[model samples]
Target: MPRRSRKPARPTACPCGTGLPYAECCGPFHTGAAKAPTAEALMRSRYSAFAVGDESYLLRTWHPGTRPERLGLGDDRRWTGLEILEVTGGSPLHTTGTVRFRADYADAEGPGSQAERSAFERIGPDWYYTDARHFTP
Candidate 1:
């Protein structure tokens, strides 16, 4: 009898459901191997960053033109999960775009959530997260 090869592990589906896998989808970008094409990609990578606690990646993707002097990653707000509400106003590979998302998490007090309609700008072949408004829920 001939020996059979083992099956390979499947990559997780991208939260955005762009018909791509998480590993090949946003994983490389989240791990600093690739660049995002649109604002939505940056946003997705940031979500992945939070999921994996990659603080440095978060800072790198932040738009330097509008990035804050201090990104307090140590702020004690534990993230529980992420829910992408909607994605609109961008192409398959956008040069400029926007992403609206709802992120759910837990803290020292209790469960909480933040909804945001974030914008982005592409600068010098790089996509940067420009603006975000946190909504009260």
Candidate 2:
């Protein structure tokens, strides 16, 4: 897909490491227009959560117990890009899924980057991030 500029008319054009637009990208997933079918979709939604400060979405997608009671929105690093490295099958009803990704952004610390390998689980058609190894996710 062609890279989208963060233009206003295109709310989904956020190069926020989402790998897709706010509209066709995580927007649909966030607004209940769709459900993530794989670990890759979950990871992209997580990236979108960070982009728009939709901590609620993040929390909602997180598995219970590990789910935070609250999420404080604050200044955020400007996101640049998302590079999906890999994805693995979880299961039919519920399975263990894995995804690897690389993200770029700018922060007070300076231009920075994150590479993560994340895990997900599908429970009754809902996909949630189970754990994020500091190594990448």
Best by lDDT: 2
- Estimate, for each residue in 1-137, the C-alpha lDDT of model 1 and write its tens digit: 99743322324875444567778887889767888876777787787666555667778888888877756554356555566676765554566677777877777878888889888777777888878888754
Q: Record all residue pairs in model 2 with backbone atoms less than 3 Å apart, i.e. clashing.
A: 12-22, 90-95, 115-136, 116-136, 116-137, 117-136, 117-137
Give the residue spans of candidate 1 off by over 4 A. 1-22
Whole-model lDDT, model 1: 0.70
Question: 81-123 in candidate 2: lDDT tens per residue?
Answer: 7788877775454477888778888888888788888888887
